[model samples]
Target: MLITIGIIIGLLIVAYFAFVNFYPSFGGDVSKERQSQYTDSSQFEEGKFKNDKDVPKDPTFSEILSMTRKFFFTKVEKGRPSEELPNHTVDSLSLVSYHGGTRLMWFGHSAFLLQMNGKNILIDPMLGEVPAPHPLLGAKRFNEELPIAIEKLPKIDAVLISHDHYDHLDYKSIKSLKNKVNQFYVPLGVGVHLEAWGVPQDKIQELDWWQDTSLEDLRFVCTPAQHFSGRKFSNGQSTLWASWVIQSETESIFFSGDSGYANHFKEIGEAYGPFDFAMLECGQYNKLWPDIHMFPEETAQAGIDLKANVIMPIHWGAFKLALHSWTDPIERVAIKANSLGLPMIAPKIGAMIELNSLLANHQEDWWD
Candidate 1:
């Protein structure tokens, strides 16, 4: 029995080492490259990008392991969520080109189908049922399939990635999209993982904070997001995490990928402010990682930071990434924005919101 136990222990050590070595540590600019055409990082003054020390202390693996393991290994918890299919069918916003031009369809979590200037962009596409590589390691997938399936998706022009967290970056999603995606805009070390998953080196575009490039008529600027990334050990800062600015002739959109409160928004707003619409993060927040995520109130504050005229709360409403009631985010954001007189829309799942005409009439508590 001791001999058998010894063999098992040896295997675990090997597996653990493999995990550490598999993902590169967060450190350098190996996969990240700077572009010469990129000039001003942001239009704002100093202190725009919040630093690491300001970010809230994340739950060390030791701090949350028991809960994580119990949740993962035990069946005491039901495998699925209780929320029903949201009644909001996506409102079809007509594109300038029926095929494209500044429109987005949220697929849940931080993923969206963004079309601008005739280019189809997919952002942080995590359409998988579960965020884990296998069912054994993580929580169950969101109860609903992405409003649209990957296979059925129209040809994509590019993929904008925020970071390497399993929730934001799904290996299975990338693998399936390898042949379909024309280009990938990702943070530094993220390309390494994508390469391992069968993505080509030429197709992946890595940008540092504030770097940007033009694609066709659409322009993509990688902005800073206050967050961290690591799918495995030793890769804490290997890859960067950031938001994105999508701009075109008729419309400009700001996406706050996953960030805590920061002064960068004002800078972004000034530089790319007066956005027609903004998709802001407003979910899975807790006091533990306070600086990494903005509370529902803070999410609204972020909208103001980007000077968004019409805003829709993403990140929440899709996945139960936090312990709050499923509806807490939308409900709280509605209350806060209403009180602050912030122009906002809380569309139900799949609901289409038209930015051009909302001042006259809009739905009330549809999610309620």
Candidate 2:
């Protein structure tokens, strides 16, 4: 019986490997020449991307085994919402007619729509029903429907991708938005995946850390994030991860694309901060991997470090990627923000928020 169980486990491991490595949805291959271009970057070394700071030693084989065992054996009943969370949908047609100041719409997790300088921009647009390569293979989205259907979205001026993680760079969402997007802005080597997905080469702009690009009146600076990247195990860290600074003439916005608490936040603040609004990751964190994701308190602190006037906690309320209760992130973050006297907003999903109005009408505790 023991021998039979071992054989079955080995076969399952091989099958899982084959699925992730060969799956088209996992994303495109990075060529040797493409990797060479990244050699000049401080974060790229030994042919793989490296974090700004060294973390605790990579999880040991025994530690990994223990975690895997617990994952399968543990009962996490509150990890997801019991019912579909409520959301407000916006009319896409109205968005096109009103040429106005900066406004934003959240679609749960890290996906957001930012309208600034009369341009519509999408950040980390993983709009599909699942964060995996296929809907059948992984956890489904917490909500059964999106606030706005992909086909109904207005023409996107640009799509910004922070990394190639399945949750942040979804395959189906890219295919759906390809024809409608005028351009794509992504971390270095991430353009390879877009190219494979039928996006035009001329439409993709890849940037290294601290590199800035312009799209009409908006200036985007690809900043650092303390995180790793990869869709498949074999191609781990072949691409870069990042945070972003989106600046218009009158306002600056910060988007913390998946990161742990790090000094980089302070450094970014000094360089290009005093932001009008900031979005910080505040969910899917675990003690085992403390170096990659931040606790809710850390999320609040990160906003202060970025010198943001108002902070909005994101990266929660959409998926069950961690063991914490569905409401833990916002609940904890709200407490931390209050204790620190940080002005924060937990906008209802799909609520259209204007940047100028943030100071006056941002504190709506819709989750309660």
Candidate 3:
């Protein structure tokens, strides 16, 4: 009997190894040579990337068990939307023909396409149907269709990735987008995954926090974010996570990529104040992990700290990663923003946003 139990345990261990190794979505490993380059970064230490603050502390065994129980056993009312979200289909001809000023389009959750200074850039384009290594392991996306198909996208000037989390950095999306993108800008240690996925090493550029790089007239700054990164269970924090500062001479934009509330917003504002627009993460939050993902009110406050001329709440209205109601994030944030007299815009999925119109506080509560 004991031998049979041991055999069962051995088989389980082998299966786990095989799955992680054979699965393309688990991502690639960072070579020792590549990891050595990160030693100079203050955020890199003890062979893994570290946050500025000692946030995201590992939960204890009891805490983990409790969370697991709550997730699998506890029912969350309205955790997902009752109906499919409404979105505007992107006109491919318009995208190709329009030579207007800077514009933006949200592709639900943390994905966006930005046209600035004659360049087309994609930010954290996780357009996959599921935010998991395998589709069966995750819930379906709220929106069944993307505004534009990945194949329909025009030639891309650059792709900016915030981190390697599955929800933010999807493998299928990258495979579809890579051939068309001229450059990929990712946080330190993240390029290895792209390189492993057949992206040429030369086409990828990796940056440490506060590091700045430019393509033509545009400046891309890899700024700080209070978050963690991992694609699989064993490799947490092996890579870095970040917010981004994108700037043309005329427009400045900030994208807070999956961050908790932190003083980094004020620091970013001080260094690069009065941004033309900012996209702040405002969802998938719970009290269990307060330090990693901000509550909704914190999202509004983050806008004030960034000194943004206008702010849009993102990271919600798409997936059910947390226990809150589907609309809780935007609802709470809008109230706080109104009380603070901060201009906030909450466009529907796939809505085209003219940068100039943001100053007039363009908003759509389409979730209602």
Highest-lDDT candidate: 3
lDDT (Cα) of model 1: 0.70
Error of 2 at 317 (Å): 0.6
TM-score of each: 0.81, 0.95, 0.97
Question: Across residues 1-368, which tens digit of lDDT does each residue of candidate 1 receive?
Answer: 99999999999999887755553321123322332222243321131222445554556778689656644455533223465556444333332236423456667667877766667788888777676545555556554555655766667789999887777888778878879899999865567777777788899888877788888877889888888776655445555688898887677888888888888888889888888888888887866568888899988888887888877788865555665665677779878888877888765554444446533344567555
lDDT per residue, candidate 2, 195-254, as tens digits? 988898999999999999998888999999999888876788889999999998889999
lDDT, model 2: 0.90
What's the C-alpha lDDT at position 364 in model 3? 55
Residue pairs with backbone overlap in model 2: none
Single out the weakest 10-residue window by summed lDDT for candidate 1.
41-50
**What Cα-based lDDT does every candidate model obtain?**
0.70, 0.90, 0.91
Give per-candidate clash totals: 10, 0, 0
Which 10-residue window of candidate 2 scores lowest in summed lDDT? 359-368
Model 3: per-residue Cα lDDT at residue 71 = 77
Per residue, candidate 3 scores C-alpha lDDT tens digits across 43-155 of: 99887898889988988999999998887677888888888888889988788877899999999999999999888999999999999899988888998999999999999
